[model samples]
Target: MKQQTKHSDARRPLMAADQSGQGARQDEDASKRSWGSEQLAAFEDRLRHLRLTPSQQSLASVVLDNPQQVAMSTIHALAGELGVNESTISRFTAALDLSGYAELRSVCRALANRYSGMLWRFMRADHGAEADSESGANRSQGDGKDLAGKNGTSGQRERRDILAAQDSSSIAASFARIDGVLWDEVVTRLGHAEHIAVIGLRQSQAVAAMFAYLLGLVRSQVSELSAGGARYLDALRDLGPHDCLFAIATQPCSKDTVNVAQWAKSHGVPVIALTDEVLGPLAELADQVLIAGTESDSVLSSMTAPVSMVQALANDVAAVDAAGTRAHLERQEALLKSFGAYADKDL
Candidate 1:
């Protein structure tokens, strides 16, 4: 919410990694946005809404898909890679209404940062005062509401509403990409696999653990890679053609997940990737790719949509082999009840 540093006033058409200067850093933060909007939307959403010429479309594809690479590349390198003149690349930025290629690089760098687990995890918000002032101004325009009169509860409720709306939107957009047939296939493979190994490291591990637990309830031989006492590779010792490896990764995809997934693929293990981008490293290694939107308003991207999708997948897996799943559930319930795991079994 800090005031966007004014680098250029004129904007037109289409637009490199200069990571050194303080001015460059400020521009990067301010320029973090989809071409069509003031703030960033999901990359896919932005692509879908934009009206791009064939040449521009091709260029945008390269830029958007490889933000990390582009963030580090100079305009000359990018233009050469795409068989376009450097001037043409600058024109492409103009088409997107950017001031120039420099602003474009800033945008891509900011975007790439969100996908970086390290950067996203550690970056702190430094715009609290600016953000509140803007919010109050917007409210004034909407209903002439005085900020001083608004209670703390109103602010809290507004924040909650924003979070809920973002989550709901994210879920809807992600689910739209996967069709019924694909989902059915996912359920069948997971349900009938001889073994299931789910691997997620870092923050992604939280979702992976929950997914593994849900899968365990519906079937046997469901093991979580890297979640328990055993190291992930050690757990993979017995994994092979008969088993499946489900790996969850996000932007600036984790190398560990990608490497493990690659190993699984080489050993004939089917890899299902739950990731934000189809072209992401983990998705490249996956035999089955499940795309999920992870865009968020804050430094941390939301996992709510991906977590919801996995939950639904678990439910479908449970229903795939109804009789077998029911028997498993009954046995598990009896075992837990026998151990008095429930405080009130009847309830």
Candidate 2:
């Protein structure tokens, strides 16, 4: 007869097995760190127990959001938009353990390329199905009046019609959702803000400028931070508790724009972000997030949705401040009339 082993003794082998499994996991993790040496080093050196200093994090998120087009020119513009000094931008880079803005950009570009390829593949797959269906329909239509021909033709036509209707309905539904998500929030937030600071970079700067101009008509203290050079930072420094920032960032985001948002948040300022998707880091920092749809026929970002949202917000703000806005508008109209800025047709 063999001696009986205690339950605890029997469990010893199982416990040892578990420990071995944990050891393997640790080894695998070590291997991964070794494989991604630069990334791991950067992460450990810069991001370990990393604090974003608010402004720096905001700016970095913006740049990370729009990986494809981030550049020094964009960064400089973003710094102006956020009302932060250029040194803040450099600090943001160092915080990421990047050599500077350029290296950060190179990393973003690589990421962008990877995403672009994936997007193209998805697009191709979508179109491929449509092509196959269309070809099948044509073949059915080409056949004469045999039983198969009649049945196939009718079936194909009905299917095609159904698909067309489905496409139309899908597009309409998407647009409606976009309108609700983006424009409605913008209007609501603008109404709540005592003062609005508009921030945008690169192509979005125009949008920011336009929003500020229109908000001025409502007698709102609307500042366009995009054009003030270092003065932008001075202006931001002066904002009181009642002020809110409306940051416009699309994919890919400008690093400067993100930094500014971080800065504003750290200072206890509220931010309303208009961007492409909720996944963007800027959206994470925003008190209110507005996601605008970017799917369009063009390769460039579709600004139409965001522009419409801004316009709607401006209109709502004006309506809310009706009396003051009307007076301000009248003054502006009088000035324009005196300058003969209207069309000659009116004259």
Off by over 4 Å in 2: 1-175, 178-189
- True-vs-predicted CA distance for residue 135, candidate 1, Å: 16
lDDT (tens digit, per residue) of candidate 2 on 1-347: 11111122331211111245764453344333321446634542343235666576446434433343343234555566557887897787776656555555555544454455336334433443343233221111112111122137776675445444444543443345554444555565676677888899876788888888888877657887874568778778976567889898876676778888899999998788877644466876787776554533222444666777677678888887678778989999999999988889845
TM-score of 2: 0.52
TM-score of each: 0.64, 0.52
Per-residue lDDT of candidate 1, residues 1-347 (tens digit): 01111122111112233345864654555476445434445543454346665566556655544455466556765765667787777787786667777777766766666545545323322332332343221211112222222238877676456657777888987887675666777788899899999988777888899999999998999988884445776889999898999999877677788888998999999888898755467866677778777765444678998899899999989998999999999999999989988787567
Error of 1 at 142 (Å): 16
**Candidate 1 wrong stretches, greater than 4 Å:** 1-125, 128-152, 227-230, 345-347
